[model samples]
Target: MNTSQEQAEQLFAQSSSEMQADHFDTAEALLVKALNMDPRLAEAHANLAWLLDRRGSVSEAVRHYELAIELQPDNARIHLNFGATLAELKFFHAAEAAYHKALLVDPTLPGTWCNLGALLAQNGRDDEAETMLGKALALDPAHVAAHFNLACLLLRKGRFEEGWHHLEFRDWYHPAEERLRCRRWKGQSLQDRVVLVMCEAGFGDMIQFCRYVAVLRAQGAAQVDVLSHPDLKPLLQTLDGVGDVFAMDDDTSASDWDYWVPVMSLPLYSGTRLDAIPAVIPYLQAPADRLVYWRQKIDQLSPRPGLRVGLVWHGNPAFENDAQRSLPSVQTLAPLWRVPGVQFFSLQKGNGEREVKRFQATQPMTDLAPDLKGFADTAAAIEQLDLVISVDTAVAHLAAALGKPCWLLLPAFMTDWRWLEERTDSPWYPQVMRLWRQPTGNDWAPVVAQVQAALQAWAQPVKPAN
Candidate 1:
């Protein structure tokens, strides 16, 4: 190598050390200097592309990625990362081509197989995804990501036996799981034993899985305590066949319980299948005081509440697919406002709450954000309404859990596995939940039109039979 090439390599080494310490800006600067010193350095271009990828500079990342691949066409790692960047940008065809190129270069790469499977799954090609993911596991059986991805695919297809088993490889164990010092529950006899159920992931997950505590109680657990999200802590106190609910922020210890298990795992241990889910409606209830408070509050807001309906159009912005899952704007739901004799209340909290104000002047839907402080408060408000219409969010789960009439709007793009393959109804919520999925990605118009038509029919008063 020439003197400039040697100097560039040194700078690249410095960038690697800086990256390990999470000095991204310093690493980026070093990488740029290195690339300047040796314009033809494929390694420098790839490294700069990666830095740009992480920082959301998509155009620059793609430019460098293309340049790197051009400089070193046979480098499998570059193609893999370039594929990932393309996938992130929703260029599925190009991403697939890139992934296939990587595999052709090096067929033994299990991670590449896993990535291809995940991308195929994301695009709704389940059969191809299954085949690709199986190859990944065949190459590397203990690959955590491959196992986890395949588990989701199987679970979505309603193949629960192996799905539940493979789901354990998610490695969801927290620091607290270790601190418990007791054996993880493996569907054992819990007669007269104290058990702690730890919450994992998000609030939607907690609400969906908390029903298992009842199954635990049925199995003769003397006390079933829940380590809950503080937001849902008070609400969970009303959950049946369960004991105390506490949050991570609370000063609690592992010594307080016997065996511990992740809340989601309750299904696996209990032999939950599609044919037999623990679908008990109204598993969660509002505190009597809050129910009464929300009832009067609703009456005051809408004096003659003809056909009461709740609406939630947005979810957490931080959610990876929020743009696809959420409606374009609050105005997107303006058609529903045209439904005669129906009163609308906003159940939307966080992120897009401000959008509610814009609709109030023209659409006149009552905004419920100011009064809702927690899940319990939201649960109480939901009880006062006849129906809830929501995007795929915690509010949908919350309403379903409460046994309220909930019409869930699901996105076509990478639909959540929990909903399973679309059938317009959910077994999770049974008779109470109706699903309205977009026909294609970012296409909410048809779904809104259908919901509006349904709402119009729904608002009509029932006539007495002769």
Candidate 2:
């Protein structure tokens, strides 16, 4: 090899070592230097693209991927990475073409097939997705992501039997979840034993599954301790049958617990069925002082003699499915503003908070988000509201956990499995919660319109006694 080629190869090797160590900045710098030295280094370009895509620079990654594929057109790995970046950017057609090309180049790539399957699933092509993911598992039986994706698809279709079984692959990907010193509780008798239920996934997931703690105790667990997110500590403490609650990051390896169980896994072992869900409402409660303060605050404002409604337009932006599940802005909810007598309070925080100011002049909605420190705070505020209208956020779960009247505005495509399809009410919290699903498209207008109509009827003045 020539001197320049040798030097470029050395730089690429160094970049690979840096990447393995997760020193992304150093890896990126080395890849850039290697590419500058030899622009035709397709592997370096592909690796750089992968790094950029992982770091969320999808457009830049796409450019690099295109260049890499141009240099080495038959590389299936390049095509797979390119397709993933395209999918992240929501270029569905381009992504599909890229995945097809990858399959044509190398049909045996299990990861590529899994990626294609997931993409099809996200686009609502479920039958095709199932076939594609089945092909992935046929090729490599232990493909964790394929199993997880298949499980999600099955659960969404309400095929709970197979779904719960496949959902076990989740622990394979998140090994930290299974790094317990104690044995896994597989619904074994806990007559004289303590059980540690570790919280997993998002705030909404924790809230949804925490109800099982009481069930565990009822099933004869002597003591049930929970390891959960720090933010949920205050609220989780109020739950019945809970012996102790520890934060997720707190050291618990030294703690004495006879067995460990993931909060989400409780359903499978406990034989939780759709018909037999522990629908015990109000499993969570807020501090008395906090609830009183919010009640007094609402009384002091004294808006009108109508329903007090809380609104959340967005969820965590960092969530993988946030693009499909979250509303673009509070402006999309404009129709709700015209419902006379009903006072709207903004419970949204972070990215969409500025939109409240934009609409405050015209809509006259109160912003309560600034004072909401945690789920406990949100729970207290929700206690004072007559109803909560939310966009698939953690606060929605908080409202439902508090057994407050909640109306969830859900996106039509790729909705959460917990909501299930073709259903308006959640079995998890029935009677108090109603679902408003977006039509099978990207538009939120229909959802907002339906909510507006419902609010209009709900806000109708009561007929006075003659």
Candidate 3:
């Protein structure tokens, strides 16, 4: 090789090593230097793009990947990387074009196919996505990422049984493998074992999966321990068959335990049938003191006794579909204001308070959340309320578990597991809950109108107590 070519190769090697070591700044500098020395260095540009993508600078990464593709338009890997980054940014159309270009250049690139499938699935093209993902798996049977992505696609399509089966392949995926290596206790038999169940995902996921604790115990697990977020710990501790429950920082490994299960997977292991779901009411109990305090607070608020309505307008902002699934507090409260003689209390938290203030300006509403703290306080308040009217949030789960009447307002394409598909009730929250699904995607107005009518009808006969 020529001197300049050899030097470029050395820089590329050194930059690759630094990137592997996670010294992104140094790697980025070296990669840029190499590119400056040889503008035709597609490998260096690709490496730098990968590093930037890993650092969460996806837009910058996309620029670099575009440059790399310009340098070597036939490079399937560069096209695939650029496509994946575009998908992350929700630039679905661009991502699709990039993935298509990659496949045209080299159809054998399974990662590109899998990602293309995922993007297709996200855009409501499930059949095509499934076909693409199947092709990816056929290309490489051991491709664990393809398996996991396919599982997600199937889950999105509401094929839970097959979905969960393929989801087990997540252990072989890169990021999931690192997370799964945490200290886990495994036992031959569950009968005498103290199984520690850990919460792996979001608050809604924890709530959805908490239903499995009893199923695990019934499956011959002698004792069940749960390591969950502190906010959820108090309520989860009251669950039936839960032996020990603590926050994530608690050292459950120090105690005697036989096995560990992620909360979400309990249903698969226990062979939980839809009919056999533990629908026991008040599975989660509030602390006595907290309950008494909330009761007194409600009494002081002098809320009209009949059909007390608790309202939550926002969910965690970090959730991918939060903008589509959640509503501004004022919009949520607008319909509830039309319901006469029903007391509307704010169950909203976080920045939701701003919207609550706007709603209170036009309606007679009470803020019950200011003094209310974590899930325990929320649970206590839900217990006191006659019903909870909420968006897709942990409060909805808390209310359902507490056996309070709950109206769950859902997006048109709701979360995979909610699976109502335009139904008025959720089989998951069997008792004391009704679902109000949006008729069209990103349209909350009609759903709110329905809620207004329902609440008005519900509050008709009940006069405010003297």
Supply every candidate's count of residue pairs whose N, Cα or C atoms clash at under 3 angstroms.
0, 0, 0
Pairwise TM-score winner, candidates 1 and 3: 1
Q: Per-candidate TM vs. native?
A: 0.96, 0.95, 0.85
Task: Give the per-residue lDDT digits (tens) of candidate 1, residues 379-465.
Answer: 999998999999999999999999999999999997888888878999999999999988886888999999999999999877999
What does the lDDT read for residue 4 in candidate 3?
77
lDDT tens readout by residue for model 3, 1-466: 6777778878999988987897889988888888877878887888889888987888888888988998999999889988888887778899999999999999998898899887877677879989999999899887788887777776655566777777766552233324333445322457766777878777877877887788777778788888788888888888888989878666554576566777766656665454455666666788777999999888777655566888888888878678767885456557667677888788889858777676566877788778888888988888788889988888888888777889988876535444524467766777678988777667788888888888888888857999
Worst 10 residues of 3 by lDDT: 172-181
After TM-score superposition, the amount by which residue 52's alpha carbon in candidate 2 deviates from its true location, in angstroms, is 2.4
Best by TM-score: 1
The prediction achieving the highest lDDT against the true structure is: 1
Model 2 misplacement above 4 A: 172-180, 249-254, 464-466
Better of 1 and 2 by TM-score: 1
TM-score quality measure for candidate 2: 0.95
Q: How well does candidate 2 score on lDDT at residue 343?
A: 84
In terms of TM-score, how similar is model 1 to the real structure?
A: 0.96
- The reply for model 1, stretches above 4 Å from the true place, is 464-466
Q: Which runs in model 3 stand beyond 4 Å of their true positions?
A: 1-15, 25-40, 43-63, 142-144, 156-158, 172-189, 274-276, 328-333, 357-360, 462-466
Candidate 2 lDDT, tens digit per residue, 9-104? Answer: 999999999999999999999999999889999999999999998887888888999999999999999999899899888899999999999999
